[model samples]
Target: MKLSRDIMRFFIIPVVLLVGIIVTAAFTVFYTTTARTSSGKIISSNWPKEFTHDFSEYINIMNGTPTISDTGKNLLVKNDLWIQILDATGKEVCNYDKPSTVSDTYQPYELLNLYQYGVGQYSVFVSSVNAGDTAYSYLIGFPLSISKVVTYVDTDRYNSGKTLIIMIIILTILLILALTVFYNVVISKSYERIRESLGSIASRTYKPVAGHRFLREIYEGLDTLNHDIALADRQREKDTKAREEWLANITHDLKTPLAPIRGYAELLSETNTDIPFERSRKYGAIILKNTLYAEQLVNDLKLTYQLQSNMLPLKKETLNVTRFVKEVVIDILNAPDLEGRNVSFISNSEAATYFFDPLLFRRAVTNIVVNALAHNDTSTEVSISLDADSGVKLTIADNGNGMTPQELDDLFTRYFRGTSTEIKAEGSGLGMAIAKQIVEAHDGVICAESMQGVGTTITIVLP
Candidate 1:
């Protein structure tokens, strides 16, 4: 049986009823047996004497009848009594027959009390009485049936049993109802907590209760469900912001190159015979540069997507770190846009060998240096250094208009621009985010320390 049902039936009411039944049954059986035994003993002891005295009284009332036949006739007149006269030698003297035609055989000097005879439930007693001095005795017989006593006792017991059974059933039902009501109240309170949790989650204001306790699996399950719903809600918010930033970044990057491309194309379309060849060549070169820049931006966007989606394949190689950094710095210094900027490298490690994907690692480092140059004032100097302790540490520092604490906190977020920078710049603002992603992919950490009006330092730690 279920726990609730068993508690209601057995624990609550059946205990009382079981005890009542056992006690009542014992008492009924004891009373019935005791009554029957006492009735038999009484009839055995007194019935014979009672019948003999009644016969003698009858003889006296008849004025001392002289003959045994006269005594028998007078005894027979009182049909309620059974009487027999016997001789002194235990021989039958006279037997009186009743109107029912039943024969009575008299015996002499036979001692009898109420004796049970035949298969019937009755007590029979026989007594010998001295009637005259002629050596004759009268034997009187009496019968008392215990069946009536037993019938009455049994009827009472049966009625009592029925009443007890009914009481047990009624009490059991009442207990069950009471327990059911209590259980419903308790369980409903538990369900109310669950309903409140659900309502909060539906309203997007979900908060978890601290130190909650649960007795059932359902309560624990509800707690877990609420937690998951809250987490998903936060994730949805993050995804919405990321999507908006991505669209804005893409539009800004595309527009930067498109403006110059469209301007050069319009100039080329006008049929002006006085157009100088050098100016024409310069405009054509600008168009080509912007076209390639736009193409590079599209490819970088594709690569970023592939990396995030787990579709980018890595080509690992062992490279000398010192030689790699020196070559990259020299290449950056030779760029047309970086001609006026002072770039320098300081390395303490000679033969620092590391294993990495060269293309990805180079991209990450170049993006950082490019971002520094773009943000720094023209008069400021950019410095790059490599130092090793347990592993390699790369530092890129620029003396530029630095960032505040708030800007530093959100530095690597996509499409987030520093307050001091023009929002119309060609930068997509994904560079630092991509750099951080690549650094983490190589099992490294990237951090920045900046002070307003001082400078910003970007540090990369690789292990």
Candidate 2:
């Protein structure tokens, strides 16, 4: 239901309003005028009364009526009207400086025509008066001086101008209305689409919305948001399943070793006189071994969780990577468990020193080396190589019982183990996963390559 404000609405309406006001104000200020007539200037609506009053004055002056006075003559003179009296003999008896084009007499129809057509040039006020018992027709004529302003005002052009002005006003209002509708109803639809798209995103629905180029940044940003949201959702689903699997694996792994430890302890603690000291010592050793294993599993799980949660602290120092690998290999070879193992160190770089957390780094390296030694036969050769191109590169390779592609792919997953791990009850699957996490925390990448029967190689690169 939310609507985005279109900037066009802000700009267009003010401009349209300004234009309408200007046009209307111009009409009011420039073209309007007061109306006028022959007797006096007056309002437009009283123009007919003014015209009739002027005509009556002319009639009384031309007829020489008893009510006439100098005031009547002054009225005719001021208005520039003339009067002529004609007898039945067709001779002019009275003249008030009539036009030379004026006839001495006129037929009734001809006079009517002159009244109709000559009104622009003359006002012929005809009246019948008795003089010495004979009837005389008085033709009072007013010379019309056409005012250009008045003529212009009276022309169809004037009305047309008024019509044009009105049309302009109406058109301006309609245009403003049209523009409002276009920007509001038409342009606003884009904002409505954006609103709906946002709602869909909130509800976790994916739908692509097209956007105008004018608002390209908003469109692109929303698209990126949509993509990221989908990716996070997919990752969340994966993490949920992985969490469930990790729990299951941990339960099975703990129970497997605990069962042996408990059984051995029970055997050794039994009140049986038939049990020999040799058998008791062997059972005690088995219990100790299983207890150490369970302890190791718990410690590995704790380390992995700390590393995953970014709580594992690091003590960084510059160490010679080549010498470091060599020292680790020597220690592995010296170990009582890996005494006869064929483990060695090889390097292309002489002294590849880098800053890293040694304790965590050593644990990562030890886990990989221990895994190699524990999985393969004592005759299987294991090598730790160190090299530097741009930075340090360490590789742990073994010619042990190699792994399949699937096992190699899942090697770094938490609680994931290959057939080698299940067969050899040695280390928890969390070792490789923890090692990968620790290496990555130091801004390094760890990769494993393996074949079905050849060997497995774990590579760590640090920048």
Q: Which candidate is the best by lDDT?
A: 2
Q: Clash number for every model?
A: 4, 0
Considering every candidate listed, which one attains the maximal TM-score?
Answer: 2
What lDDT score goes with residue 261 in model 2?
A: 88
**Predicted candidate 2 versus true structure: per-residue lDDT over 219-245, tens digit per residue:** 677788989999899878866777687
* Model 1: pairs clashing at backbone N, Cα or C within 3 Å: 84-139, 90-108, 114-124, 115-124
lDDT of 1: 0.67
CA displacement after TM-score superposition, residue 55 of candidate 1 (Å): 42
Error of 1 at 68 (Å): 46
* Local distance difference test, candidate 2: 0.73
lDDT at 285, model 2: 85
Candidate 1 lands at a TM-score of: 0.55
Error of 1 at 407 (Å): 2.5
